[model samples]
Target: MEIFKSDKIFDFMGKRLPFLALSALLFLGSLGIIFTKGLNFGIDFAGGTLVQVKYEQNAPIDDIRQILQAHPKFANASITEFGTPQEIVIRISGSSTELGNDIGDTVHTLLDPTGAFEVRRVDMVGPKVGDELREKGIMAMSLSLLVILAYVSFRFEWRFAVASILALIHDVTIAIGALALFQVDVNLDILAAILTIMGYSLNDTIIVFDRIREGINTSKESKLLLVINESVSRTLSRTTLTSLTTFFVVVTLFVFGGEIIHGFAFTMVVGIIVGTYSSIFVASSFLAQLKFSVNNYRAREAEKLKKQKEKEKMRAMYEKGTV
Candidate 1:
């Protein structure tokens, strides 16, 4: 069940410069979109009221929107169908307290009129709390990257760690930028998905790095680029299979998981695709560009040996009563 058998050599590192240039273009374009268009932030981070309602029968969304808009308080509310035609979720820019305790009742009465609809749930977040959560989300992402940097540096080399971190950042930035580009609602669930993406991407990177290290130690390939190219080619089947399987699951979720999980699934789909690409082209290619070769390791080992020899010489001199 292997997609790539016989150790097909694709020369992934051969086009490293072109791939890197394309990635840089994408990264910059995503940044532009993120800054200009901005994200469609949901109630979780924007501070608002979220009401999920189910009607006894299918109701016209336009009629509901019109009725809500007629009222001064609900004029600027956002209304959309949730899971089905009979269910709808409404979001308004205000906390429960600010909107008053009867907010749910008011929506039910106004929208249903004959008490045919029921408010399934109501949630709210104040502006201050929303701001705090936004800050915390940023901090969480930053800290995760920092921790990963430290871990990878300790486990491998600093150059590999830096390249891996950059690749991860590329994946996350592209994911977030996709949200802003598509106007997907950025929520806490999506934030969680992004963090999950970081972990997933890191695993893929580590796998490739491990293979590269093994190749360096065992293979007679003198060129670092050749070793990396061979390593990526060797692991091509595993990376492809894993990404394809995960992609299918996320695509299913995006198609059928309803509005609640739509953003999360979408984020995963984007993350997986970007993560896989970065592991091969971005992370591995960057490692090659950094000149990660046997020479670097040999140089370090030589320095260590020199220090050890110096210490032994000093010990011998001291034992022999020589200055």
Candidate 2:
């Protein structure tokens, strides 16, 4: 069944040099930000006290912040509004043995003076747990990329694999960099977003690669550039439509998903846009440069080796027979 059709727009096949420069600039800038100011890990990554309090009525987040800050133990605490206005998520930095109880007691006094607010949950994570989580997050991301590379290489070619992986890296780095710049909390939720982005980005790259493969197989007399341009043009409608539909859903969540999923949805939106652009400008373009045919080259090499081996065997048989 036909899902969509391509509407030819100004060919985006030209001006490859400028696009490369812009992408490089973004990549290097993100790297620089990462080195200069590392990720702003939230409680999930840094191991801290998480306190969620539910009030009878909506509580003022700024007032809660002030209440936490009044105590020296909870100074510099992070506070976020969650769910209805009545709920607040408080993240207090790691406390020493002497001050942990005092910090909790102070928050209790401010919010539940007469049992107005109840402590929904109170959890303390050790620094070791945070370190382990950080390690695991990196491992998951690395393993995911390796798996994609191997699968793409096996299914298509190394050139396609490299381009797809690079695009994934680009999307992830930019997401992390934006987080650092804004001091966004790098937590398990954010990690989930990163992985989600990887999957979506890889899907987009695979679709484009599929089209490129089809073009090469079907068009016998088409030039490399023409084939690439056509492949991109043909798939452009489907890519844009799918991305747009997905983007609208993400935008809805971004607007209404509340504080809990805001960052996650935002990251997903960014990934969709970046993934689409890379599929066309990055993956297909790289494929053209490769100009390598896996099937043809392997078949030719195997044929040449087989012919040499047959000749060697025939000569050996003739010498033995004469002797």
Candidate 3:
């Protein structure tokens, strides 16, 4: 699907500064929001017992809170409407299966003494286990970013790698901040969504970088800016098609995927939008900031060739026992 004119040249760099300013605002604001608001970690990361109950009629959210607070065991339980007014989910910190079950019975008796409310589901995770998972999750994300850095450096130049990394950071941080802003439950599924976002963000940036490299290699493009503009313009169609298609699918998931997958779908929807923008604006503008050009590439290559010859000369000397 050709969303943009193939032959038309777009001056993406013309409004680079404004786009960059906007990205900075989002990136910084996301960071600030994350630090202040924090994530509402699910049982996967924050050890807890979850009890999902459904009543025959509209659930009494306020009464449920009051009753739970009155009972010492159920006190501090997080209560949220699961799917509808009739369905409710209660979460409490701690992970004793036997005790959680006992507490579930207590909740059922207190909330619906008539037994009309049904216990739909229950889950538990140990505090120690949740701590471990949280640590591992952070480690996983950190390692992924490091690996991306190394991989991009290998595939392209350091300038491209740095630009790509910054864009990805922009994408993920903002996504996380959105989660924090809305107080979405952070679980294993959300973690998976984030990793997927990283991959998508990288793919988009890499496509632009690849096009720039191809353009530079084939043409005597003295000004890297011109080549960057042309490369971005050429790849716009592919990027747009991918993003739009993915957006539609995720939007569908968000609408009908149910409560279990709602957070995951929401993360994907936000990530796609942020990833697309960062790929086009954040990554390209940062790359431009490095002042990299065809001349720089040529110079770097020449230096590599010089060092290679020097190494070869030294190897020959060593082979001949000439120090």
Per-candidate RMSD vs. true structure?
Answer: 3.6, 5.6, 4.2
lDDT, model 3, position 269 = 99
Minimum summed lDDT over a 10-residue window in model 1 is located at 108-117
Per residue, candidate 3 scores C-alpha lDDT tens digits across 1-323 of 78889777788888899999999999899999999999999999988888899889888888888887898877778899997889989988776554645766777788875337888888888889999999999999999999999999998989999999899999999999999999999999999999999999999999999999888866567787788888899999999999999999999999998898999999999999999998887798999999887887867777988999999999999999998
- TM-score: model 1 vs. ground truth: 0.90
lDDT digits (tens) for residues 220-302 of candidate 1:
77788888888998888899999999999999999998878988999999999999999888999888888776767756767
Q: For model 1, what is the alpha-carbon lDDT of residue 255?
A: 98
Model 3 is weakest, by summed lDDT over 10 consecutive residues, at 95-104
Better of 2 and 3 by TM-score: 3
Q: What is the model-wide C-alpha lDDT for candidate 1?
A: 0.89
C-alpha RMSD between model 3 and the true structure: 4.2
Clash tally, candidates in order: 0, 0, 0
Error of 3 at 239 (Å): 0.4
Per-model TM values vs. the true structure:
0.90, 0.80, 0.89
Top lDDT prediction, candidate number = 3
Query: By TM-score, who's the top model here?
Result: 1
